[model samples]
Target: MDKDKSIDHQLRATWQAVAKMYNEQAANYGSTMAMAFVLLTIDKENGTPSTALGPLMGMEPTSLSRILKSMEDKGAISREKNPEDGRSVIIKLTAYGLEMRKFSKSHVYQFNNVVREYVTEKELDSFFKVTSTINKLIADKEIYNAISQDK
Candidate 1:
């Protein structure tokens, strides 16, 4: 394989390993990595609508709404109808959600440390830039599809 292809394969393998690690610990964390990030995003934004979280998590709106309902029922979050837009409901973390955030932070820090041990800072920076570019490209494709579908 070409050098670039080899590196790409390695990067994917590394991501898979990281995902497996998260899955193994998800029960202890009370959420998957994706769910944890959704909570963190809501925390950062103070609140986020269920609609927005779905797109951010790359999940269908109905599926995300179901998950959010479960979280609310579990006392991890609260959802309120957005006064300005009744069609969208905003989510806020409860005390339990805040505690989960603290736990996730430590785990994330440890994960970063492990990655740092394997890849130099400069290499990681470059890798992130490339990954971001790829994300942007994919996002644009999604946007285009949405726009086309509205016709």
Candidate 2:
């Protein structure tokens, strides 16, 4: 087989493995990338207003509301009226959510370590650069812009 095909096959296999791992966790939490992004953002910001989070996650307002409501129902997130903007609602992680975040932490760390073990540091850096470059082209820039505008 040609080198390019061989590499493609390996990449696909690796991606499948990663997807399987992600699915195992995501299924348990009823999580998607949108959900994970919200969790990660709340972790970083302590809390964020609903209108702001909508664009950040590239989700429609209705979809974001549904996800937030589910999280709230699960006791994974709490919503409060924004002090500065009473019309906007703020979303925060509950203690249970924080604990669930911790559950994913080790898995994420180990996944990184696994990748690092197989790929050199320079390769990892290159991968990140390429990944970001591709994402810039593919990711919804409008959504990002809307989020920034909110900020």
Candidate 3:
């Protein structure tokens, strides 16, 4: 058994590599990977609730705020008060934003296709299983609470 190889370490390394790859590709369009992600997340038609965007993207409100502001300034997105709920806001994508979203979606699909070409069906299934297990464990607070209890 190789104790040096940890699941978290592997996940971190894989994510770092993926992020770098995305950033490199996004640079050609004069945008960061993060911006492309937000573009892709927003609703192209009906628009999305502003309060829900952060949780949907698994991002901190402060971080999301900066991205939202940048997107608004670029005229890629617009914000308006939600008619149903005046206290809340809605995020709508502009025509330019729709174009950018399509571009971002294409890159994401290309990446998945490339990965699928290399990874087998069985391996991919197992990878999803592992990830789902990890998510469940975190949601249940099994790992953290267990260790804290030991100490």
CA RMSD of each candidate after superposition: 5.6, 8.0, 1.7
lDDT scores for all predictions?
Answer: 0.77, 0.75, 0.91
Q: What does the lDDT come to for candidate 1?
A: 0.77
Q: What is the lDDT of residue 139 in candidate 2?
A: 75
* Candidate 2 similarity to native, TM-score: 0.69
Q: For residue 22, give model 1's deviation from the true position in Å.
A: 1.5
Rank by lDDT, descending?
3, 1, 2
Whole-model alpha-carbon lDDT for candidate 2: 0.75
- The prediction achieving the highest lDDT against the true structure is 3
The candidate, 2 or 3, that scores higher on lDDT is 3
lDDT, candidate 1, 1-151, per-residue tens: 8766786688788889988787666668667776666666784446877778876777887777777777777788888899889988889888888887777777788888998999999999998998888788677797468688999
What tens digits encode model 2's per-residue C-alpha lDDT throughout 14-104? 7788878776777787665446556766744468887888777777989888878888888889988989988988888888778766656
Kindly report which residue stretches of model 2 are placed more than 4 angstroms away from their true locations once superposed.
Answer: 1-19, 28-34, 137-151
Best by TM-score, which number? Answer: 3
Clashing pairs in 3: none
Q: Which scores greater on lDDT, model 1 or model 2?
A: 1
